[model samples]
Target: MNAPTSPHILAAAQRPIPDAFMAALTARFGSQCVTSLAVREQHGRDEGSLTAPPPAAVVYAESTQDVQDAVALCHQHEVPVIAYGAGSSLEGHLLAVQGGISIDVNRMNQVLSIDTEDLTITVQPGITRKQLNEAIKDTGFFFPIDPGADASIGGMASTRASGTNAVRYGTMRENVLALEVVTASGQVIRTGNRAKKSAAGYDLTRLMVGSEGTLGIFTEISLRIYPLPEAVSAAICSFSTIEAAVRTVIETIQLGIPIARVELIDVNAVRMVNAYSKLDLREEPMLLMEFHGSPTGVKEQAEMVQDLASEHGGNAFEWAERPEDRTRLFTARHNAYFAAVASVPACRCITTDTCVPISRLADALLQCVTEADASGIPYFLVGHVGDGNFHFGYLIDPDNDTQRAQAEQLNHQLVQRAIALGGTCTGEHGIGVHKQGFLLEEAGEGAVAMMRAIKQALDPKNILNPGKIFQIG
Candidate 1:
């Protein structure tokens, strides 16, 4: 297989769009609406280490009406419309493959309403997870679909993102209750109600949750919130081997421990995190954990988990009770990707996520480590292991064809092993452009066909986030 070239290189150097098309876009959207050079380049890229393709124009949408009008215009012109959120997607979700319009929703960042009694908050599509949390901090409540980065709430819902808290609270699929979406035809429709469980009709709200913005543009969302935990305790436990650490997690979950967060970091990840965050953590495979509840309840849970870890050969456990200490610990954990990237000079990080059955986690992780070692690919491993989901970050020199090919081979083998263990190719990140082949292999022809039907039924014109989830003409 050939190395993946930079999308920008392909678009600008190999497949540049005609000037007449740019003139038509400007005529339709006006001068203030269209951005060409630097702005277009920036909007087309994302947190994913892959090279970005500049959208022909980047439009700053101000309201739902703006999105509707923009999509309507694109539909009429038979051009592709790619929705842009915080640019934090790891799977090339925002790259403008057809290169028409990058509809940026940043200006629409507004908390529409806060239903305190109902424990739900309604917000515009552009509102980020961190901004929402900060706005609702004083209310003693929070929306917890955290994807590490302060990603837009819409993007989180679109990608079905889950992070540290997913072990306890669940992912965006459980958090998002309703959505006001603009369809491909520029028609706005509400998906569900604020009421918890509805059996009235088809569950459209969920169908859109991990659609990767291929179905419609989410204009507003009503999300579930939870009261802040009464007590919170965080700790770190080191182990000699990654397998031992993962086995401890599996055992803890099997024993019905109500742990709020249990993340596994391989020895390599621990080293990179220490250097990146300037902390002197022991460079060994470790489990970073947290518990939430009454002080007594948290203590009991921690003790129970400590016993399980001991059985798995876990070393001394270090607990952090102070708020500042807990904050610093989790902050470093969240920055694991950046730390991994920083460890390698002039190399881009390619991350692959896979989830397996709890009993198979140890085997899966060990296999991943062995593959990386055998290939001599510099990599780091970290995961929400409590959910049996883990990620591998491979730092590769994309310019080197042999190195890039080897990395892809390793990634493919990892995905194959995960699927063989009855897990998914992507645990949280949706099947955007990068993992479409894996998705087809895992889900099979029938499932892929059903997904295509849904896409066609909702977006007949193929204008809503074209060339994502699965490739289209």
Candidate 2:
């Protein structure tokens, strides 16, 4: 059970939007300012189980000026403001919990400029990863961050999201080179230039990358792009047990093999993918891997992986060299979240993402799965184990109080274990609302106090994404 708060804690109160603010926004945005219930409700929730109440209104921002104007007005009224991208967040990052304004940036999707020579791309914040890749696929280059949701670049940066490719290309923190952000008072500021490296002041670019929209609104982003590999091959390997599969990942990473992608899915997850995506595979723990290099280089990597797998009781390595086969294999793996949730009818899934040190992964994972299994809650287990990161999508009936409690308890235990193992409360997923408490535990009083001080200094009015990350008076 959660500890009752101390008497000094102040309860969060939802403030009503003033009529003057609404009138001003509508006049400034014309038809783009939406206040209808249908639209407001759609912008309120994301893909997560927790849906905060809808915002009082939604402003479709088309450019930096639009966002600046809207934020300025909201700041003037001292109303809460939340930034909305694709609404693909797993945590309640985009919800307007304090009944203020939601500045939607999806309409701002546009690839502004591409610099092949510099190997960088500048875009409006709302462009999706797939869409960005599609626009530049013919250029022999692609963006490497794939959070599996077709999520917006702005949202990806907001949550600092990562996925299977992170083992090779790094997360948004490493790829996002610079940003154009609107401050709390609606002033526009650029963080950096196109330089590959900088010894500049403060590193504000890194600061906004994972701020979860509580710090500033991202109006534009510059990202590092990678050259497409000459040869890419994918394969699936079955293991005798989950522990064996995890051990194989440990060995592979320890050997310093520059693998492109390595993901783990337990037998139950494989079964769900087989049912939902309609593919026949062995009902056992599995590792889905991909290698990006020259033909001979990938072949050499495959041999090394095969040897490592065999040492751990793994069997039946199925390789996919053809483009269609590779796409199909990755598609199924990327859709693991949907497949898992679909396994149970009328259920809400809580995808608990925790990352431990590579050495402690197997131990931490065993404890998490054991506790989840013992709880009798239905779940699907998957992980990008190469980086010691994984998620278990706990399926629970939304309306059933007992199921929700059981699922929360299961998450609490798993997060506690991960923290004890010198891991984080979240890896790729940012510290959205759900893990606020865990953030306090993981970052401790000093670090959190420092963060709060910075936040207070920047957003003194406390109007930006209030009730998220941490609670402050």
Candidate 3:
């Protein structure tokens, strides 16, 4: 695999945003069109450490027409249009690498439709996961594709995100069924229908689902939602070693257990979360798991998992059966990134994620852990281990080049190992600015060439989030 690219590259390709375009945008959007440096700076960065000049301006788009107008203006001016949502992406997905205008869709938050009979909900792109769940709570359905953060459905779909529950309910690639997209030329088009399956033409919905806003900007998304489980139980089991915890997960999956979620939190992350979230979690390699089904089925699944954990030297399961207790537990798991960030003062996070086949997970994880331990870097480990996906957030002082290089080296090794073991460089995080080289190495020349060809065909002027996913030739 190619080495990790530096995120400090200057915006040498930044094109000027014409005054006429700004004037037109302000006329069309009124106060929604903001040139404030603070807003631009806010829209420019993401959770990871990558840096770039802020977009020339920001537009708070509240409707599909608003997005279309903004894109049309950008296309007319040949200015990059970066779609901004909740700003939760970790791989610099929101960075405006080339000078442009950011179309902030968070103001477009609304639920367009809910097909309770069909188990589908169509929502505006700006509605977050928590908001969606809340909106549908009375209807007894919840969106299952949670990427930890209360990310916007549009952003989640853009990244093809999967999280703790992905092992059971699948990712955005599976949950998202239809889309209302604003093309680079500011044309609104609908892809697919709310039907469960389709054999009609190209699978454009899937193509745009994880395009990271390169192909099109999502205005409306129709998602498959699931009924709240009949019974739910969450438990945490401490393991003597990370390997044992991973092995138990592998065995549980191999046995075809329908586990809803199984996440691994290393000792360091557990410590961080304990302090950051004010919880007294066991300071050992632990698996935070949940079982969903009928009461009997949940009980059976938990017992089987407990037995498997016993074989691997996992301590007794600490159960969180009440809804409030379960929420607290999962909230802590979701807050792990922040917890890790707080562990190091003013440190930039160089985070990386990789996934391998279930059988090779132990091999892939242990080697990387050893390398990380030897590197003497302050880092935290966490994973949705049931699906063989894990992340490392290496904390580095921004001024320390050596620490950054060491972190990058460790990231390189981990990605290479994951790819070599028949896995991917990024299991959920799309190839934004950070993983461009790795995507090329993983998908190879011909595949990425086709991706570029697709990008060129759909976005001829490349106004939609330029310089992301893969660099245009």
Candidate 4:
């Protein structure tokens, strides 16, 4: 393996900014408000391999009033305002496309209220999923929108993120009860309440859940919580082929198994995990499984899934019940992307996620793998298969034109296949410039026009995270 090269370092350094912008920002916000260049650059991009121009300035906001004032100032100056969180998004969602003020929300991390009776928690948007969960640990309840990253609740809500547990707990769309947002006009408004359901006027809460921060900046969030199960068990099951593993997942879901986490890892990913994590495991297609319920319920559920796996020629099921063991298992799975990148130094990681119907998952995955092999691109496969969503991480040398072309070809073919099979180009990761064209292809021109109209109606000034989900005309 070769040493990693900073491909976009020079370009990022050369990115220009307005001379008076920093002075104005400092005048408005004290010296402590602005972060150093290292911090600004760190908050500018996400885990995705795409390079983006860093923001002209980053503001450390501490409260909703601060966010509102900052946004109002940007709106007045005709500058873009990008909300910054933990920078864990996978589609370059945090990139300062228009390069203006980045409202860093990490300072606002605080759990304001936890209503045990209502099973809801009100927290500042910058609070991460892990932090929230730890805070609520002793309450016998937990938030379930786990996006594999310790991502901020605000970022997760913006992206409408879901993860391995989505099959059972749903995504941020269902888990977020309400949101306190600063609109494009810089007015602060509450979207919803603690009520379980409502027939409100416009359902603005749901609309903003997946808006990718293009419409408003979330200051605080009210999230639905679930009672921590009486028992939790995780397992790993191997299969002879990727087809068999996917087929088993489809069958299990069709059977309505209450699986908490059912992820699919192709043989290639298993190989990478072995090399990166130093675990001597079978180099075959595998499924990382989990169940959350009462002891009896989890036992019965595991039995049912085991029988289904057996029908698909799956190998012996190895279960992990201890918390440490469970953590080790998921830690490896969560680090799968980093492991794949580690396989080839000096390579940029380009990952694409697509969701298909459960029945067509095997066919879709087979086509993706076939195209990847034919193009001779080094890639690894892993996904939340229970929900029919998967990701392909392609390792490419960006300087090599042939490698770049091959990766693009594979990405195009994979997305086309997904759309043709009545699936979406992206399931969790929002269309943050990387998939704008594919989104247009997936949702026809009329749909795109309607989306643009909504954007205009909500954000007439176009100051909130401009040039994100859609191209402004």
Best by TM-score: 3
lDDT string for model 1 (266-346, tens) is 889999999999999989999999999999999999999999899989996999999999999999999999998889888
How high is the CA lDDT of each candidate model?
0.86, 0.89, 0.92, 0.86
What's the ranking of the predictions by lDDT, best on top? 3, 2, 4, 1
As a whole number from 0 to 100, the lDDT of residue 139 in candidate 3 is 93
- Candidates 2 and 4, the one with greater lDDT: 2
Expressed as tens digits, the lDDT of each residue in 317-376 for candidate 4 is 899999999998888888898889899988888888899998889889997888887777
List where candidate 1 sits over 4 angstroms from the true fold.
1-32
Worst 10 residues of 2 by lDDT: 3-12
Q: State TM-scores per candidate.
A: 0.95, 0.97, 0.99, 0.95
lDDT of 2 by residue, 222-250 (tens): 99999999999999999988999999999
Model 3, 5-25: lDDT tens digits are: 584544647888888988898
Maximum-lDDT candidate: 3
Task: Mark the regions of model 4 whose C-alpha exceeds 4 Å error after superposition.
Answer: 1-21
What are the candidates' C-alpha RMSDs? 2.4, 2.4, 0.9, 3.8
Model 3 residue runs over 4 Å out of place are 5-9
Q: Which is the winner by TM-score between candidate 2 and candidate 3?
A: 3
